[model samples]
Target: MPSQSAVGSIETKGFPGVLAAADAMVKAGRVTLVGYIRVGSARFNVNIRGSVSEVKTAMAAGIAAVEKTEGATLESWVIIPRPHENVDTILPIHYTPESEIYRQRVEGGGAPLQSLPGNS
Candidate 1:
C-alpha cells in the first residue's frame, strides 16, 4: 500500500552534522531515518518519515543538532505530508531494510528506537 506518512529531509554541509541530526531526530520524536542523499560539495541530506507532527518535531531537533556541530551548516529542509508514491520510486527517500524497524516501531505507535552500534 502507498504510505500516508510524511517525509522530511534536512540537508547539512557536512557528514558529521547530518549524522548528528539523524540521531537527534529519531531520539527527539517518533520518526524513521529512511536514508540520506549526498548532494556533492560535501553537502548531504538526512531523511526521515513519520506523521506530520512527528516529522516536524524531528526536523526541528535535527536542525538544532546540525547547528551545534562544528564546521557544519544546515543547508535546507522540507517535509512532505503524504507524498505521492511515485516520489518514493523516483527519489532516494525510501527506507531501506535496515531502517524498516524504525518505521515499524513508529507506525505501531511506539517510541522511536535507536540504531544499534555498527548497524548503519
Candidate 2:
C-alpha cells in the first residue's frame, strides 16, 4: 500500500474544545479533517491530513482555538509528515466517509487512501 500524507493532531480536554479546534483547523488551511479519537478521561484528538505546510497551519489554528475556548485544555498536538502506511492502517488517523470531501479539496489531485467506512 502507498504511504499516507502528512497528519496533524490536536488533543483537547473536552468535546466542545475539540469541536472548536476541528473547525478552526479546516478553516485555517487546506487540510482534511480526517477524524477525532476519543481517549479516556474525556479527552479527544482531532486529526487532519494534508501537505506538511498545510498540516502545520491547521495544527496551529487548532491549538489556538483550543487555547481560546473556555474550560478547554490543550493536552498535546503533533504533525507527522509522510507517515508510514502501517501507521495509517494501525492508528486512528485515516480519513472517514464524512471527511472525503474535505480530503478531495485539500489533496486536489490523486485520490486519498480508501476511507474507513462508517462514522469516526
Error of 2 at 43 (Å): 0.8
The true-versus-predicted C-alpha distance at residue 46 of model 1, in Å, is: 0.9
Residues 1-120, model 1: lDDT tens digits: 235688899999999999999999999988889888899999998889888899999999999999999999999989999889899778888878878766777778434344443545
Clashing pairs in 2: none
Each prediction's TM-score versus the true structure: 0.85, 0.83
The regions of model 1 sitting more than 4 angstroms off are 1-3, 109-120
lDDT (10s digit) by residue, model 2, range 1-120:
224468998988999899999999999998888888889798998888888888898889999999999999999988998988888888988888777766665666635436434324
Model 1 steric clash pairs = none
Give the 10-residue window scoring lowest on summed lDDT in candidate 2: 110-119
Candidate with best TM-score: 1
